[model samples]
Target: SAPVAAAPGDNYVVDDALTGSRTRWFDEARFGMFIHFGPYAVYQGQYGSCRDAEWIKRQCNISWSDYEAKAASFNPASFDANAIVQLAKQAGQKYIVITSKHHDGFAMWPTRVNRWNLRDHAGFSRDLLRELKDAATANGIKLGFYYSIWDWHDPDFVGNFPAYVTKMKAQLQELVTNYDPALLWFDGEWTETNPTNPWSEQNGEDLERFVRTISPQVITNNRIGKRRLVDGDYGTPEQSLAGSPPSAQLQETCLTINNTWGYAAWDASFKSPTQLVRDLATLTSNGANLLLNIGPTPTGTVSAGQSGALTGMGTWMAVNGAAITGAGYTGLVGQPSWGKVTRKGNKLYLIVNSWASTLHLSRRSPFTVTGARVLGSASPVTVRAAGDGYDFLPSGGATNAIATVIEADIATPA
Candidate 1:
């Protein structure tokens, strides 16, 4: 008889010890910064017209020797860890996840497992990860590491897969032991067909288990084990938003600010600050966190366009952050065409994207609206009982042009 398959939530049974305070912190951290800095940044996501990104080495089909040579000259002189963390705080991001090792197989931190790392190969003086961890700690921000399981530079990856896994484990041990990261975000688990990527489901499980043994307190993502709901502590939907909440109790959507995850000098298409704020509200409404990405330039500085967008977002978060941070899904009111809804206790925040003179709630809504007011403003919104249900009328136009949040006080139905 075929082996019985595990139930929906049984594939990766988390140790009760792992999901204590750390998991709670993660759930409450509604927004975070994802840094994609690697050798690929040197290329600026361009190879003539190919438009390569973090996968520039594979996408452009560059020879290994050429890639290595280019990597040797990689030196980011202006990398400021404190400044980055400060920016995160300004943007109302409680946490950050930076790439420790991308698929290119270059470790940002000094690693003894291999010389193909920042300190040894690139001849860089500073420990990038250590600087970030220290800055994050000082700024009261949680720091996580994003490591790619696939290795393009490792010679043993194709010939002796287990040897590669052992090296990977050693590198991971270094990160967990030295950095003490709050989270470990794994990626590059997909089994591609071209060279026949050999990453297997069992590998993911074993790696996850190994991570727990070393640091039971750290949170990990589904990519650590087969990209399934049961693989790790939470589900990670990349490059796009999840249409609905995933089967995993905890989910995070990772999206790039521009078209590419790595620094693309020519890619000027960036989402407006209003759109990002709205995205945050939408994700929070579904009980999901948003991990927005930033691709730093070769000089180790955020581009003007990216930083400007982040500044704009920071401005909005300064005013209406309560609507996002620590907020969760509230089924009392269905999603309205005007905007999204998020709740914290008896407070239901209406993130109005399209301002209207009046907002209506159906009679069947599960909660009674007691009062309403603009989130960041001193003025109160008039709440009245209507024949159909409840009506909310703001005193004036939206206080914020991007997305105006109205705090609605509610009482549970009897």
Candidate 2:
């Protein structure tokens, strides 16, 4: 989504002090866990060649009545909220964001506004949101909710646009007041595809205003109105890292561990742990948070392959987390051929994804190094002045299996 510039004299301003604090906390928490589990898990994106299982109703072109019947059978008895939170903690994620309501309009929590939610319509008797929220709180992990504005099942949304907006507000009130999510990731604001009835950007802004009134501290994404960087607290870049590094707003890069955001029975192509860590490092160096997603199976359990990948990432974070946490783009230069760079205060962390006994910095670096050492270890790396840049010679044992983080004490040019 392209970022839109802020309008002149816009009154919809977030409290600067609160926004600054929240932004700092968000940036320091570089990695977050994204769960996309819903009734769609039952379909697993297996309807023909469609990959988004979460949108199976639309993908399969199922009638509303049939989809409602399908919701009646939805039961995730094996869902272990504590287990999921534990796995996220093990993966070194500072926050967890789960889908309370996807585009399918199936609310994970009990809602008074609609009976189509999990507690009222589906066979599940438990409130998934409450369970996950409680577990996240117990574990000291910040919790966020993903809410989609488009609801195919709601008749109000189908025929009455204004009524639909009111219902949406009521539901948002329920979520914010009951659960208190740290962030509210809104989607489907561009529900303009429906030729019969189109949702407008003004409606989105009004909805956002209501959300803020209820929960002023909650962070929101740009997808609510005009999918743009300045539209919300952060830029929600999904699937790929295509945009130039976000400067005016907080930035997040959301990606699935595999090809699909929702679980797919036929989709087994999972990204390697090494690649995941590299992406995390690269995003961190670019001053963006990585919201890595894991689509749980229909049985409410994360796939073994996905868990293994996260575990591998945990191993990497165990050693080189200093390079990520509380770090941001150094503004030294673009990402180097070898890897990336993140900075905190006077320290520069050179993340070496491709190991070399001797590494050379770009001529863009204007700092003199007093000392160099591998992060998380005291093993020193020899640094000497090159003509324009600097060269780092690693002491034999100063390396990590995935990415070696070298911390340099830099003296900036006067």
Candidate 3:
């Protein structure tokens, strides 16, 4: 069937097949880079137990006037767009999403509606988003933008809700026209409710309509309003993967490289590449994408620690990425005690993150194993048919290794 055209000002009805194509693209993309850079990076200050270091104003109870003052000196001279994109490419990421606007109400791009933008207020004068967009395109990576609905610094937000919404729409229009992002990630919709709060369900519907009208092909997340499962193009479960995959809906799990989403100079805790690789397998097996985040330094350099971790993950991804990309949840229920499983067609990927004497499977399956081999190496594994299941026998003693990808060809009962 042909797609019906939307009225001039009405929301476009996305074709079901187009939506599925978008979901399939997202599912196969598998990994992406999430960035949380803004004026907050200038003050990598910490608070006790507050993970969102980016929300420094709210967490520290700083006055809006004082917080806005930081923009005057917010100059990240070392921000290298090409370098960042290259690093993400090396990490085997397919896309990059950065904060275009945060709760601070400062637009990273030049905006006709707001004077408090990168060129005017931050005084950086360079269009950061444009640089990243070009770099991403050159590197064959998709570009996405993150925008916040809650504006603490916008004066009209205090009392005039309609005016604020108008301003938001205008600013978004600039983003759509100037940057042309593939994804629009909205945040800060769960702020305190007031008469002027523009995050009601109906308002969310309207905002999504505005977005679709501007960029018909852009995908949006569920944070437009209350972030209900039905609100947006995909589900965004932050910091953790969903226990069960959503029925026929897209899902992406966003996790920070460290404890905080924004740069925290004092925050030394970081996830090892091995743990992240294992996590990648675990999340992909459940039919989800992992959006790993990194908060760049105040001067806009990717921290050595973060870069090293990404490099390590790149090494692992170079070999084991076949188990992630183009893979989805297996028909089998529940996770294996030894490792996880990702499937594509009749191929089963046994992801082993830990060494075990034996590997187990679900008690019941309708498939018979034909062959098995370890990924990245010619090492062979022994697979034997057990009643209603199978057992994997490893050939070597590489238990201390980061992860092992075992590929198996299984014929499903038709």
In TM-score terms, which candidate is top?
Answer: 1
Task: Give lDDT tens digits, candidate 3, residues 7-122.
Answer: 34323344333565555667788899999988888777654454347888888876667767776688888999999998989888899999998888888888889788878886
In terms of lDDT, the poorest run of 10 residues in model 1 is 1-10
Runs in model 1 lying further than 4 Å from the true structure: 1-10, 192-195, 227-230, 245-247, 363-365
- Candidate 3 has what TM-score? 0.91
Error in Å for residue 364 of model 3: 4.1
- Kindly indicate the candidate among 1 and 2 with the higher TM-score: 1
Per-residue lDDT over 1-414 for candidate 2, one digit per residue giving the tens place of the 0 to 100 score: 122344453333333345656566787999999999888887767756555678788888877877777678878888999999988888889899999889888888999987888889885888888999999999989999998888877777778989988888888899999999999898887746766446676776676677767876888887767643126678788987655553656789999898888888877898999899999988888888999999998878899888889999988888878888888888775567898888887888999988788888875757678888887777678998775688888876536778889988887887
The alpha-carbon lDDT assigned to residue 198 of candidate 2 equals 64
Q: What is the lDDT of residue 39 in candidate 2?
A: 82
Residue ranges of candidate 2 with Cα displaced over 4 Å: 1-17, 48-52, 191-193, 227-230, 363-365, 376-378
Q: Cα deviation of 338 in candidate 3 (Å)?
A: 0.8
Model 3 CA lDDT for position 260: 84
What local distance difference test score does each model get? 0.86, 0.81, 0.80
Ten-residue region with minimum lDDT total, candidate 2: 1-10
